[model samples]
Target: MIEHRITSRSVGALGSSGVDMSFLLGPAVSSINTVRILAGGGLGEHPAETWQVFYVLSGLVEVTGSDDTHDAPRTIVLEPEQAVQWAPGEQRSSRALVDSLVVLIEATEQIPSARPL
Candidate 1:
C-alpha cells in the first residue's frame, strides 16, 4: 500500500499563476487515472480539452468563466466535502477566498475529437 503525508515537497505550482498543487497521484501510478491533490489560490485559465474535478477540503473558492466578462457569471462556494466538475473546452478559473485546501482531479489523457460533419 502507498501512504505519505501531504507536504510542501509533494506540492507544486501550476502555470504562471495560482496555488500550489499537491499531487497525491501522478502518471507513474497507472492505477490512478487522474491527478489527485490539495490546492489553493487562483488556478488561472484552463487549457482546452482538459477535464477537471475540484473537491473542497477546507475553506472557500470562487470560480469564474471567461466566456462572460460583462458580469459575474456565478460563484460556487465550496466547503469541506463539497465537489464540482468541469468538462473539456470550458473556459473557467478558480481562486481561494480564504486559506483553503482542495483536491483537484484531472484526467491523464486528452479528450477525444469528434468527427467532422
Candidate 2:
C-alpha cells in the first residue's frame, strides 16, 4: 500500500500561507492540506484561488469571507466537525480562536459532499 505522511510536510518553515501548511493531494483536480494555527494566529486577507473548503479538525476557529451576493461580510465560528466553503474570487480569512488543526481543500471543480478518507 502507498503511504503518505501528509503532516510531515510542515516540518520546515511556514510558507507564504501565513499559517503552517502541509500539502497532501495536489496539482491535480484539487489540493488538500493540514493547517496548524496557534491561538491569535491566522491566514489571509486575500481572495480564494478557487472553490475552497475549510474543515476544522480540532479546536475552534473564526472564519470570515466576503461574498458578491451579500453586502455584509460573513463570519463563522468553526468548531471541530464544522466547515465552511468559499467560492472563487471571494475574500476569505481565518483566525484561530485556540490552537487548531484544519483540513483545507481547494479546487476549481466541484467537490463532492462526501468522499472516502
Candidate 3:
C-alpha cells in the first residue's frame, strides 16, 4: 500500500520557492499533490501546463491568474476549505498570507466546483 506523511515529510518533490510539495497520487493524466508554504512564501506567475486546481487546506492565500479569456489579471483570496482552478495555458501565481497547506490537483477531467471562496 502507498503510505505517506504528507504534512511532515518530503515525498520526493524538489523544494524550491519556499514551498514543500508531496505527492498523493500520480504523474499521469491526473495527480494529487500538497503544497506547504510559510507566510510570505509563494509560487511565481507561470503558464499552467495542464488543468489545475489549487485548494487551501489551512491558513490563507491569494491566487492571481489571467486565463484563456485574456481579460485583465484577477486575484482571489482563499482561506481554509477554499480553492481556485486554472485552465491550461493560463498564467497564475499564488502567495501564502499565513502559514498554509494547499492541495494541487492536475488532470484532464472536468473538476466540479466547490463553495466559492
Candidate 4:
C-alpha cells in the first residue's frame, strides 16, 4: 500500500500567485486523482473537458464561470469538509478570501480533446 504525508514544503505553484498544490493521487491512479492545494486570492482558467470536484478544507472561495460572463459570480464559503463539483465543459475559476486548503479530485482517464464546451 502507498502512504504519504504532505506538508507545505511539498506544494508547487499552480500558475497563479500564492496558489500551491501537492498531488496526493497522481495519474498513476487508474480511476481518479486527488490533489491538495493552498491558495490565496488567485485565479486560474482551465479548459472545459476536465471535470473536477473541489472540497474546501478551510476558508472561503468565490467561483466564477467563463461561459457566463454577464452572470453574477458564485460565492461559496466552505468550512472543513464542504465540497462542490464543476460539471464537464464548464469553464471555472476561483479565489480565496483568506488562507485556504482545498482538495481536488479529477478523473485519471483523459477526456476527449475534440470536445470543448
Candidate 5:
C-alpha cells in the first residue's frame, strides 16, 4: 500500500498560467492530481493522448475543446461538484473562471498489464 499527505504547500506548477497541480502518490497506470487555479488562470491548448477527467472542487471553470472531425470548438462551464472528460486525440484547454480547486485523473498510454501494487 502507498500513503501520502498532500497539502496546499506541497502542490507544484503545471506549466499553465495561474495553475498549480500536484500528483497524488499511487497508481502505476494512471495519474491523479490536485489542481488549483486562480481567477483568470488556465491551461493552454493541448492535445489529449489518453482518457482524462477533470472534477471541479470549488469555484468555476471553463473547458474548451475540439474533436478530430470538428473544426469548431465547444466550450463548457463547470461549477463546483461538476466534472468533464476528454478522449484521446481531443484538443482541449481550460481556464479558471474564478478561483478554483480541481481534481485531474487520467490514464497513461503505457499502462502495465501485469503488476503488483
Candidate 6:
C-alpha cells in the first residue's frame, strides 16, 4: 500500500508555466494529483480525448476552454469547494486568480482487454 501526506510531500514543477504540484497519487497508481498554483501561474492548454476532473481545494482559479463546436473560449471562476469536469475533445487550461490548490483526476484508465495465452 502507498501512503503520503499532502503537506509532507514536496512540490515540483508541473509544466512549462512554473506551476507547482504534488502527486497524492502518481500516474503509476492513477492520474490523481494535487496542484498548487501561485498567482499568475497556470497550466498550459491542451486537448483531452477523455474526461478529466478538477476540484478546487482553496483560493480562486479561472478555468477557460473551448469545445469542438464553439470557436470562442468560455471562462469560469472556481472557488473553494467548487469542482469542474471537462468533457472529451474539449480544450482546457487553468490559471490561478489567487494562490490556489486544486486536485486533478483523470478518469481514463488503461486495463488490459485480454490476457496472453
lDDT values of the candidates? 0.49, 0.69, 0.69, 0.49, 0.66, 0.64
Candidate 2 vs candidate 5: the TM-score winner is 2
Model 6 scores worst on lDDT over the 10 consecutive residues at 1-10
RMSD to truth, every model:
14.1, 11.1, 11.0, 13.1, 11.8, 12.8
Better of 2 and 4 by TM-score: 2
lDDT of 4 at 78: 54
Please report how far candidate 6 places residue 80 from its true position, in Å. Answer: 0.6
Q: What TM-score would each prediction reach against the true structure?
A: 0.48, 0.69, 0.69, 0.48, 0.63, 0.61
lDDT, residue 51, candidate 2: 71
Model 1: per-residue Cα lDDT over 8-38, one tens digit each: 2333334344455443333422222322223
lDDT of 6 at 11: 49
Task: Provide the lowest-lDDT 10-residue window in model 1.
Answer: 108-117
Q: Write the per-residue lDDT of candidate 4 for residues 1-117, one digit (tens) a residue.
A: 001133233334565556554333335223444344445664586644554555566777655553333455455455554554555676677777777767665654332221221
Candidate number with the higher lDDT (5 or 6): 5
Candidates 3 and 5, the one with greater TM-score = 3
lDDT at residue 54 of model 6 (Cα atoms): 67
Residue pair clashes in candidate 6: none
Which ranges of candidate 5 are over 4 A from the true structure? 1-29, 68-71, 108-117
Answer with 2 or 4, whichever has the higher lDDT: 2
Candidate 6's error at 47, in angstroms? 0.9
Worst 10 residues of 3 by lDDT: 1-10
1-117 per-residue lDDT for model 5 (tens digits): 111123233334565465554333235337778899999999998988676666688999999887444669878788875665666777788999899999876776422221222
- Pairs of residues at least 3 apart in sequence or in different chains that clash in candidate 3: none
